[model samples]
Target chain A: MIEGIATLATLGFTLGLFLALAARFLKVEADPIVDDITAMLPGSNCGQCGFAGCGQAAEAMAEGTATLDICPPGGKGLIENLAARLGVDWDFSNSTTNTVPMLAYVQEATCIGCTRCFKACPTDAIIGAPKQMHSVIDSACNGCTLCIDVCPTECLQMVEVKTTLTNWRWNKPLPLAQLPLAA
Target chain B: MPKLSIRGGVHPDEHKLTNEITITRVPTPERLYLPLKQHIGAPAAPDKVIHEIIHKGQIIARAQGSVSANIHAPCSGYVEQITDWAAPHPSGLPTRTMVLVNDGRELRDDVSTPVNPLFLRPEVIAERVSQAGIVGLGGATFPSAVKLTLGQSRNTPVLIINGCECEPYLTCDDRLMQERTQAVMDGIQLLAQALYGPDTIIAIERNKPEAIRLMEIACKDFGNIRVMAVPTRYPMGSEKQLIEYITGRQVPAGKLSADIGVTLHNISTAYAISNAVRHGKPLTHRIVTVAGDAVKRPGNYEVPIGMLISDLLAFCGLKEEPQRILMGGPMMGQALPHAEIPITKGCNGVLAMSRAEVKNSTEHPCIRCASCVDACPIGLSPLTMAAMLKKDKLDQAVDIGLKDCILCGSCSFACPSAIPLVHYFNYGKGELLIRGQQQQKDDEIKRLIQGRQVRMAQQEKEKEEMIAKRMQAIAKRKAAEKAAAEQNSEKEIA
Candidate 1:
């Protein structure tokens, strides 16, 4: 029992020493603020921010290599939040323009029932069997536009989503003096 | 005795002042404004041209889709205009309307000869009902022909005629049952005949003893027909609750009454159906209960469809300046911004309530008292749903049975804190729908980008293959030339 205990202690000590050495050699000194910035991003990995992904964008921002308002999908809201969180002075005018929300529609007349677009969809929003017409599950889609380039028949087209009565909000009324004259 | 009841409901004050009054037929108005979208589905497409003279009961607009119902002119007149007007919706948005100016002469288009419903096939009865443009008069306004077809297809065994005018201020159904009892029974029999001999049952709330007694006496001759008075409950008129109370069967969520071998029709709808099948008349008029404290005359009136609310209120004698003008019962009715909106088939009551009747209490935060939970008929967690919706977490709200809500307004009425639960649920539903549309658009953009990448990669592969083939061909030509030159040298040396 004593010999077994000694061997276990020695093994634990040796492993601990080896781990300490490896940690010193291979440790990646990352800024803690990078993770905070990454959390603030949309995490869609759309690459519209001119980086490999959201993670790289966050890293570039932390290192001062990239500006605060590079994400088009994030819009003004993200820029404001990021600037406030990072304590940086960001020019509101230099922010990337927001892209309008669009939905992909398959032009059935031109579609050859090719399943290539369906296979390329990352969100599993496009549904169909081989050689069958595919339809997008609009609720599940993240607006990535990954499936369009793979469509062999060039049948897919992006359309701006229409606002329905249910989703329509009352617009803020202008001041009485600024209102247009009655026709 | 345990009262025959559904799971959860609230008993509001029953202000039924017009229950005893007989229905009075109103004189045809000078003008009638009919909104094309009286029913739930797509609005009917207008076929009549402007300035065209049309007779009473003439088809002004055709049904746009299978789910839509036709719109008929209520009075013989010239089509003044086909324009957008304030519709009888909660939003009060402008919808396509047919404006007809009544020409004093009540000339109705000739209807076909009435056929005995007994000999006619079920399909023929359904077609006749559809042609009459009859819809559910119980405030749902779903096309009655669709419900009849569904009942026939499902082979429903029981036909429940709902005479339970359970809404507090609505008494048109009660008055109809008390006065025209035979007509309502005949309508039920006709509906049963259309559904291939289903057992007919007439259900009336216990609050209206006279209606119950009259209906019982009317159905005594028919051996298969039964008239039962259910306990007076706020929403016993709800098809699901009524079906459960009478049949002792709970309709599964998302399924219709026909799915459970039962068909439910409102008593007013049955009355209309009987009129259409036996009398060869179309549904151009309905008994509207014009009641509220603000009105001088509070009673049921046989008002022609497309009559404006303002005209009805004037005819009823507005006692004081009306504080609120509701299109239906106070519980489920929409409070109109103005009284110019016209009445439709679904409008059973128009309450021009005074300030005293309108609760002007400020909404308070929910105290988690579970009063709404107790009042919810569908047994949903209104508190949790409201909390999630408040945080703009619509997906989480929907995950916890948001779609199952019937918008009965019980939760709002029963809340001690007055949280406006129904409004929160409606807002959540609308936001979720918008999110769904946005997601679809996002998916489309992703698909386009992916397609472009694939096309570019294919082109690159093709270009690489072409260059490799050309390089191989040039190498083969050079090897052939070197071999030929070496052979020539050897021959010259020899």
Candidate 2:
């Protein structure tokens, strides 16, 4: 019993010592600000920000290599939030206008049943079997246009979708305008 | 009378001015614009040809899907146009509408022969109801045929007739019950028969003693039916609340009343069914309450479907240029930008309120008072939901039961700070739907990208295998040529 306990203790101490050494040698000192910026960004990983993903974009921003208005999906909200979090002064004039939300539509007549665009779509918005005319599921399309370049028939087109009554909302009326005016 | 009460409701001021007035049939208008999407679900497809002369009660639009209802012509007229116009929705978006011009003949098509509803099978009754385009006249406008089918399928044990006209300034249902009690009761009996002899209960609020007396006397002839006067409460007419009050059964959240072996129909819907089944007449008109302080003459009018609100308001005689014109009751009605919009199957009231009656209060921040919690009939936290929505944390708001909200204005009315709680919920629901759709798109894009990668890798593997096979073939041919050359040299040396 004594020998077994001793061997186990030795093994545990040795493994713990090795883990401590490895951790010290391979430690990645992640900047807290980078994490905070990443948290502020839309985690879509759409690569529209010219980075591999939102994490890389956040890292570049922390290193002062990337600007605040890099994410298209984040829009003005992310820029404002990120600027506040990073304590940086951002130029609104340099910021690009937010792109209108769009969905991809496939022209069925010219689709050629290639299935090339279907494979390239980042979202499985396209539905069809091999050698069959493919159609885009409008609700599932992010308008990333990833399928546009891959389509041999050039049948994929992006269209802007307007908000319908199902998604329409009443903006809060101005408070002063609603109050009765003194005659 | 034993009175039933529900949890978490508000008693708004009952400004029912037309409660004592009888229903009057208004003269047909010159033009009627009927939006195809009069009811919930898919909009009906226009079946009549443009410029064709259509007789009254002719099918103008057929139901596009199972969840939709047919739309019949209200008066004999020529189809002027089928175009888009501002619909009677809160968003005021343009929807496809069929405009008919009255030829002034007031001609109606010959209806089917009247038959005893009791002699007909439940399926036949349901089919007849569907053909007549009868819908729930209590603001929901769900096709009554669908409900009947569902009740029959579930073998529901109880049928609740909603006579609780609880909305402020809306007395159409109350007046309907008082004037056509026997018709309404007949409708209830027919619906019960369709639902396989379910116990029928007509629930009316205590505020309308006249309607209760009439309904009770009318129901006495039916052995299985009972008329119960429930306590006066705002939104007691809601399907969930009514089901609970009548049967002491709570319809589980995100479920229908039929799921719990109970079916509820509006009193007006029952009355419409009686007319449709007994006389073989289609639903061409409805009783609309035109009441408010701004009206010179406030009373219920039996107005034809597709009549413009402006014509209805003019017929009622407006006392002044109304500050606000709302379709349906004030609590849950949509304010029309102009009076040009037409009435549909769902419209129960046309309230033209004076400036004094409209409380355009300056909205104040919520002080964290729990009055909204007490007023919410569905038992949801409006304050927390509003706060989460303001922060744009929709998932968190949904986690706190945002989907359970019925958009009742009770919380908004009870809030002392005037937070506009219902507006926030509406906005939140809309935003959630948009975001959910976007997320679905993102997921689909990811899947497509993954599929592309898999396909490319497969192609690359196939190309590598072809190249490997070609190289092997080339090597084998070269070795054979070398062997042949060596054999010739050996033979020449010999």
Candidate 3:
């Protein structure tokens, strides 16, 4: 039993030393804050924020070089969340542009089908063959607007999603006294 | 006597003031707005049905899907353009509605007389019910034909007709049973005939003893039909609760009542079924109760399906200013945004409540009193679910039986602190549904992105391979030319 214990002890010590050496040698250099910020991004890689990608934008934000409101698609909600997380003062008045949730719409009549929009689209929401008309998939689109700039015929446009009976729901009901008089 | 089987129900004031009043027919309104989605399925495609002259009892919109129900024109009129109009929901959003102008001709497209229901085959009866656009008139509004077909296929041993109109201030079903005794009974018989059932039973709440007595008297002739009076409770009218109270069988969570070999039919649904099968009539009109302290005349009215609440209320006349207008019983009915909304097939009652009648309690924090827990009919802890929902922990709330809640408003009624527990549940349920739709969208987006990435990589690889092949071919051609030139040079030297 003593011999077996000694063997196990030696084996454990050797493996522990080897693991320590390996961990030290194979350690990856990373900024955790940057990674966290990257996860918070919309991740469409549309590059509307003027950064190389979501990762680069995250890196710039982490280094205090990039403005907090760089992401147009993220809109006001993302900025408020970021401000809360970063413990920064946010002035709502300073932001001139207010963005609502938008989806890319394709005008089938005018589509040139140069394949530029599809090549530019990060989500590949646009479905079409070369030299044919393209249409946007409502569910697949994240409203990145990357395809809009590339469409040569300017067929693509951003639009708010239409509310239907199936998707509609009660917005917190008003008290009885506040109800509008029916005409 | 045996104790009441089902537990955790509130005994709110019934306020059945119009119980004794017989159903009065309301004059047809000038304009009617019939919504396409009166039932819980795919909206009827009325695009093609338009342009044709509409008449009373004529099908204006055919059932589009397997789960959908047909929509019939209540009265004869010219189509005034199909458009989006105010819906009956609390949201007040516009839905697709068929607008018809009353010509006052009272002309029906095809008026057929009553036929003997006993001679018809069960399948034929179901088909006729479907053609007549019959649906559950007990506020559920599920397609009656679908339920009949489902019940018939299951070979369910016994069928329980729900006469337990437990909602307060709603006596339409009671009035239906008391006045149209033979009609309701005939409907039940017709439904049973469609099912080819082994046994038929009617369950009426003890509160409606008159209805019970009459139904019992009606059942004496038929050996298969029996009447059982259950304890009058708030949610006893619910499918699951009633099923449990009568048969002592709890429908397992996330499963249909039919899975347990039980199929339930609402009392009014049976009545409508009888009319469709025998009278050769479509469900164009239904009995509705107009009551509350604000109304001068609180009585049951035979209302057309597409009649606006404004016209109905005006006919009833107002005694006082209404603090709130509810479209069903006070307990579980939705507060109407306005009286201009059209009454659909599912609307059983319209209550123009005065200040004295409105239950507008200010919400308070829970005291951990466990009152909500005791009041919950589905045996869920409303307090815990509310707390979780407040914290936006939807999955946690769902894990604790949020989906099982019948939204009877018992917890809200039972809470001493006046916490709107049911309201929270409703909002939570709505938010959960929206979130579920969003999650589905996200998944679909992810799949499309992955597919795009794969296609891009394949294109890149293919392009590289093609370039490599072209380079190799060019090199081979160059070597062949050089070899041929060397042979020519050697031959000339020789």
In candidate 1, which residue ranges exceed 4 Å CA deviation? A1-183, B1-3, B437-494
Residue range A1-183, candidate 1, lDDT tens digits: 999999999999999999999999989887889988887775657676778888899999888898886776554445656776788756644545654555677888888777998777655668888878888876555555667788888888877655443346333212123435469
When 1 and 3 are scored with DockQ, the better candidate is: 3
TM-score of each: 0.71, 0.78, 0.81
Residue-level lDDT tens digits of model 2 in A109-141: 888888887666655678888889999887666
Off by over 4 Å in 2: A1-47, A52-100, A103-141, A145-160, A172-183, B1-4, B444-494
Badly placed stretches (over 4 Å) of model 3 are A1-43, A47-101, A105-115, A127-135, A148-163, A170-183, B1-5, B47-49, B111-115, B461-494
What total of clashing residue pairs does each candidate reach? 23, 8, 0
Interface root-mean-square deviation of model 3 in angstroms is 4.6
Candidate 3 chain B: minimum summed lDDT over ten consecutive residues — where?
B47-56
Q: What is the DockQ of candidate 3?
A: 0.22
lDDT of 3 by residue, B1-494 (tens): 33465789988888888999989999989988999999878888784345567778888888989888888888887778799999999878899999888888888856665467777888888898898888888888888898888888887777889999999999999999999999999988888888885488798888888898898899899999999888878888999888887778889998987788787888778888878888888998999999999999999999989999999999999998789999998888999889999999999999999998666676655689999898888999999998876655566799999999989999999999887788888888887676667556655665766678888999999999999999999999999999999999999999
Which sequence of candidate numbers ranks them by TM-score, best first?
3, 2, 1
TM-score of chain B of each: 0.89, 0.90, 0.93
**Cα miss at A35, model 3 (Å)?**
13
Q: Model 2 over residues B1-494: C-alpha lDDT tens digits? A: 22246878999999886899989999889999999998888999999989999998889999988999999999998999999888898667888999999988978877776557887889989998999898889999999999999999889998888889889989998989889887877888889888888888888889999999988888777789988888899889999988877777789988998999998889889988998898877888999999888899999999999999999999999888999999999999988888889999999999999988899887876678899999998888999988877655666788999998988799999999988888888877876666566555445555655666687789999999999999999999999999999999999999
- Candidate 3 CAPRI level: incorrect
lDDT (Cα, 0-100) at A99 in candidate 3: 53
